[model samples]
Target: MESLLECIICKEPYNQSNRAPIILTCGHTFCKSCVHKMSQHSQYIRCPIDRKFESRDLSSLNMNYAIVQIQEYERTGILAKERCKAHEFPIVITCKTCNIDCCPKCIRKHLSHDMYDMEHPTLIQELDNSMNGFEIKIKEYLDASFSAKNRLDKEISELDHQKVKLKKEIEDAFESLMRILENKKIQSIQQLDHKIKEKEDFLKQRLNDVNEQIKYYSMHYDEFQHMKKYYKESTFIDRVVSCRNVLRELNFVQFIKPKDINDNKLRIIVDTTPLIAHSIGSVSFNEKSSSEILMEQLNFQIEELKSNKLIYNKTNPEQKLSLEIQSISNFLCMSENIPELAKMHLIECCCNEILGYSSLKLSDHLKQELSKKIDTESLFDTKIQEYIPTLRSKLKYVKGLIYSLEKIHEKEWEKGLYVLHCLIINENEYDFAELYLQIALLRICSQSFYIINQFKVIDALPLVDLIKRYTKFHFLPSTMCYKQVMSSLRFAYKFVENQMPDFFFPYFKTQYSAYLTEMSSKATENIPSEYPSELLAIFQGLDSSDLHFWKDSDLSKQFLNKVHRFKEECSPWFQALRFVQERGEELSDFELAALERSLN
Candidate 1:
């Protein structure tokens, strides 16, 4: 009877002394004492059913009235002592054979049956142990359910994230391809219109010339008739004799409109295979159909282009601007795993739309707004530190957009670069002293170079100042930083040497070149010979064969130390070095020279 009203977690009966039953956040009921014990173990009580974080304090839990009612019903049985229903006597022993509770009087009727002594202390102890074991099994099942829920929820969240990212990538790629097609379409239509307008103007001029000649002949014929009717025969003959020279000189060349030459007319022959292949191509509209139906639809569209009553469901520029703003803002909310290809493609699409707004002074407005948001004084204020990370991420996004615009758009290139220069200078004010921030600045400078070279134009003074600020103040010559510095310098050299030769000396190109050479020699000293060609290109301008340049540099001792250290390491190259050192006596002079050079 006591087993029927116990807490599953503690296997203690629900009673006034044990504090009855209390419901947990997991919807399982336990005694108040057990809940307090759980709270003492951890700051939070994990729900056994789902592992959800729950309050540890027992005061917030509700009392289980259902368990109270069940306890009351069990307690009120047969006047405080359960008795046999059939015999109307106090129950003493339970018959094992008949599976019934019985009294001493009832046992006379069941003398042949086996029985259990209900008063046996060992049997009561065994029952208590069984109840305790059942409680443990119930807790185990709850824990297993909680773990499964956790794993499933995580998988569900990750899958949803991936689905969103994949959809976005598909949209971005198609948006770029659509822009390319629209530009091509506009170009083709403009060329066709120009050619047709030329022909139409020529025809109009010819028709006006023909009309003037007809009027000239009509006036002369009318004058000739009037002379015959109003003057003497001699006068008429004299006039005719005088006009004969004019009439003989009169020559009319008929102007016939030229036949439509099919070659001159635009005959759009679209290749349908590329569309089926789902790839980029010159053709836009294509169909796999019978020739008759294709021509009918084509002719209909050609006529439709001339119609003035057409309704255009075009998006307004303001609406497009808003949509683009939202799209770019989505980048900030994205937490992880954005592919570089997708980033470039999406930015290019946005830049294509932004090109139409060059007259609006959008870049200047954006720069002012961003700088205001990231004011130097506010960043140092005590209250704004928590919001610093969000502001930094948004600023980084803006810098990325500007870099992309400089690469892809022409008219906006100068404006974007100017804005980016301001942003880099602004960033320096806040994070100049930090090493990681300086590393980021180096990468920004590196990215800026490709765009500058691509457009073949720059505000050379600002660019030079920006580069000097990063490299001079924050010079950390690690492998990655070295590559970035050398690349930018190479682009800077090309930009000066080819495009702006006159701007070279005043902008410190010579000094920068020397700095790049030093960095290259240091950066490439420890690099293996099998490193990528891109890495090798950074050292291209710095002569690898210049023994004096390498030997005289400050990094030469460090390089020598590294070479010796490499020889001692356990690697394939080190094994080869070890073999050569072991067999030094057998090597010829040329072979020995080659081995020595390999270490250098």
Candidate 2:
């Protein structure tokens, strides 16, 4: 089975010293010199002879491991142990490398050997004695741990059973006691009623006896007065009758609704107001896909910057005024003219062909204007006001378009997805802030409003509110959603890196690292037994955890550069998140207008 051939170069019988060669694309042998020469060009090394590529660090190639096995049979002259690669003696060591096989004799020779026993003549004897002691201790600890765990488990099971039994018993006893108490109260009420009636009757009899005597006296007095004939117009008997009036009374009780004797009809009601931030704009879209839009908005100042640049001679050599960059800076708008400009621009783009017919038909004049130029103004339909009514309709159609695009992306774009990674730049100031806030509101509400079946392509990212929320929470978002968000981020990250790096600082760094780690762990944990190149790629650069650099208040600028590098390193590590990185909120004209409608 061993080599029955000769070496190509030497033309000699193959011996253990010489080995079979692996071919490379360069028509060279797979010898160390051949591979080493190719290493200087790239991190990946492809066999020039075979044109095979290993997309990993070439330095990490295990040449010893990958090389053909020993060319000859073992030299069987002596029963001596195999020699160590380094010491060239009978092996007697467990190598310092994470784990390696070694024999007893060579183990004591190497000073770096992790398990070497230099002090002892018979190291194996000493190791066996130490191992026996270690084994005894381990057994003792394990035995104690097992006993405790078993007792706790058994007790927990018993307690659970007892809890169930006691709960049932208590409920049954409580019901029976309630019935008994109710019966006793009813009987007591009956007895009290009988006693009250008897008392009332006895009292009535005594009152009647006294009343009869009084009646007789009154009659005798009247008769005597008549016989005497001394009565005037105001007689004595008439006066006495007028002075005292007879009294009649009956007891009444209040009525109540049926619930229980212990229950009351009173109810409690509370109205509380939430401390909600006033939104710049809101969306009728679902939250699932609006995350991308949210990220873009987050990266900028939202509304366009209107800084009036005023430069002057510093030394007053020429008192000259420079420039005035102006727009109404107030948060409460000065007028509707500015928004009109935005709307006009948006309409001009006409990016949303899925216009709502009803909204367009709101006014005959506007409908005629929009219909005249659908082809020319698709991407630039900036006026968001006129389209509010039909926003839902247009949104419905556009979303359908998105779904269609996803279903047949090849037919539609030829490219997997074509996205504007840098859309809607320069977000600053109250107006821009308002625009962005609206963008956020639009993003947050977009996916929440739409259902899975209602829209063609479901975008669950770039909703401004959701993006803000997600950034604050640091989450592993949906794959499609993340793709869209990454597009938004790519645009915004440019501005942040160039202009607003000071604002986000290390927060982006921290979150970026955390996101990569979480994504990688998920990839590794869910990796299949078979090859998972896609997942493996995601897991790369995730071994290192996020390194914090900023304190609560005092942070230097040095941390910023580090943070930038960290994010850059982690950016390509997760392909799942990257695949959908650029797909974002594709809002219809009416949908954009719908946001303005809620503003009022």
Per-residue accuracy of model 2 over 1-600 as CA lDDT, tens digit each: 223243333444432232334344344444444455567787678765357775555344432321233432234533444555543344555554435646555454444646643334466676688899999999999999997887578658766986798778777877787698689668867876776777677667756766776776576556556544533445567644433221111112122222232353233332222312422243233333222332233223123322211222121211110010011111111222243333333332222211212233234454444434333233233444443323222222222222322322232211101110001111111322222222232233333233211322123222332344432222233444444443433333332344434545455545543543443343322211221243234324232111111011122222223333423432332222333344344323353334323422
Lowest lDDT block of 10, candidate 2: 414-423
lDDT of 1 by residue, 1-600 (tens): 566478767787876445557777677777777867777888887655567767646666766666666665676842334545464355888777887878889989778898778877766886789898998998998898887787567557755975798678777778888888788778767976877778777667766776777776677667666655545556465666656654454434243444445555344444556655866544343443222332344234223322311211144322222222333222222322232222222222323232222112235544343224333222112232233343343334333333423332333333333333334443332321132233333334434454455544344334544444444433333334434444445654655465655654534565555556554442322211131243224333333122112112233333333323322421323343334446543234344334333433
Which runs in model 1 stand beyond 4 Å of their true positions?
1-90, 103-109, 119-140, 159-237, 243-247, 250-600
Highest lDDT among the candidates is held by which one? 1
- Each model's TM-score, in the order given? 0.29, 0.26
Q: Report residue 155 deviation for candidate 2 (angstroms).
A: 1.1
Question: lDDT, candidate 1, residue 538?
Answer: 34
